[model samples]
Target: MRSTVADVMTTEVASVGEDAGYKEIVSTLLERGVSALPVLDGENRVVGVVSEEDLLHKVEFENDTSARAYWPPMRARLRARLSGAGALAERADEKAAGRTAAHLMSTPAVTVAPAALVIEAARLMERRGVKRLPVVDGTGALVGVVSRRDLLRVFSRSDSDIAAAVEDQVAEVSRWDRGEINAVVEDGVVTLSGPVRRRSVAHALAGAVCGVEGVVAVTNNLDWEIDDVAPYPQMGV
Candidate 1:
């Protein structure tokens, strides 16, 4: 079975109020050793996220009189000039002028539900280019935080534990003969080898094994008697 976000998330998350000062935000990050923090409202509901990149933009833009001053290289400066990088820097400078989390944060934070699968959370983080995600409830209150490290916890399961789960969950649920299928797990990789009655059964068995928690990868070595997926032959009229 798939592990949910709540199963692997850290409940004690470091967050900041919308009115938190820039210095306070930086202090919190240093104290917690985290790269980002969720910005919360008066009622403690997440509104946005403030990351190191967001805070650094201020320093980068405020110190440079011209984009070229920071960009340095002529070719890179030329590229920035052509690509509207100057406008982006100007906006960053404007943001830097603000002194609170409300002005520095990236709004409409990409969040995940507590009940979401770990794989789903990983996919969201990958797609959004984020290193962590805030786990929220239905009311959008932050309950926990999930990091890239949390998603990798599954791989730490012992081989014996994975083998037992595969036998009890995957093999039994597929309804294939338990004796016919042998599940061998090595370093979290499961190999399902045996014989099934049909091609669909073989595929289903493989899928079931893959869905089991702690399964890093699945190898299907099942032999099938019939190809149910094969198309019927056309009759010559």
Candidate 2:
């Protein structure tokens, strides 16, 4: 079975209340050595997240735009414009005026369920451009937190373990001969090579091996005797 959020998430998470002050949030982040903290309500339910970038906005926008002696150089402005940093700066300026977590945090915290697959959590973080996700229950209460590092723990499994799993779970289940189908694992990459009765079986075997935990990549080099899905030639009278 695939590893879930609960399998590798850190149950002891550093969080802040909605009423936490800016300095307190900074202190917690620095002391805990975490990039962000989940903001919870009175019910301990996650509402948002306050990150180091969120706190930096205060320093970035401390001076008003009108106070500048001269406009930024054309090149600098062009780079900012291309990266959308200009728009982000405007929003940061607005956030800088706030004094508490409620006003400073990014709302609608991106979260995952404890039962969610680790890959799902990784995809969520990638899609949202965040480094971590709060693990929440069905009621949205924070239970733990999962980071990119946690999701990558699967890759640390020994190569022997990966090969064993592929051989037992994938090849045997697919009815492929243990000797015929060679399962070679190296640095989490699995290479399946041999002969199979049908092309479909080869594809299915490869996919199954790919889903195994700690398998970084799958190389299928199975020669098939028959192409089951190939269209047949028309007959002529």
Candidate 2 C-alpha lDDT tens digits along 1-237? 789999999999999999999999999999999999999999999999999988988887677567444578999988998999987766677678879999899988999999999998988999999999999999999999999999999889899888888878564745643336778899898888887788888887888899999998998888878888666778982
Q: Estimated TM-score per prediction?
A: 0.84, 0.84
Model 1 TM-score relative to the real fold: 0.84
Least lDDT summed over 10 consecutive residues: which range in candidate 2? Answer: 170-179
Residue range 125-160, candidate 1, lDDT tens digits = 999999999999999999999999999998788989
Error of 2 at 112 (Å): 0.5
Q: Once model 2 is optimally superposed onto the true structure by TM-score, how far is the C-alpha of residue 197 displaced, in angstroms?
A: 0.7
CA lDDT, every model vs. true structure: 0.87, 0.88
- Candidate 2 TM-score over all chains jointly: 0.84
Backbone clashes in model 2? 0
- Which pairs in model 2 have colliding backbones? none
Ten residues in sequence with the least summed lDDT for candidate 1: 170-179
lDDT assessment of candidate 1: 0.87
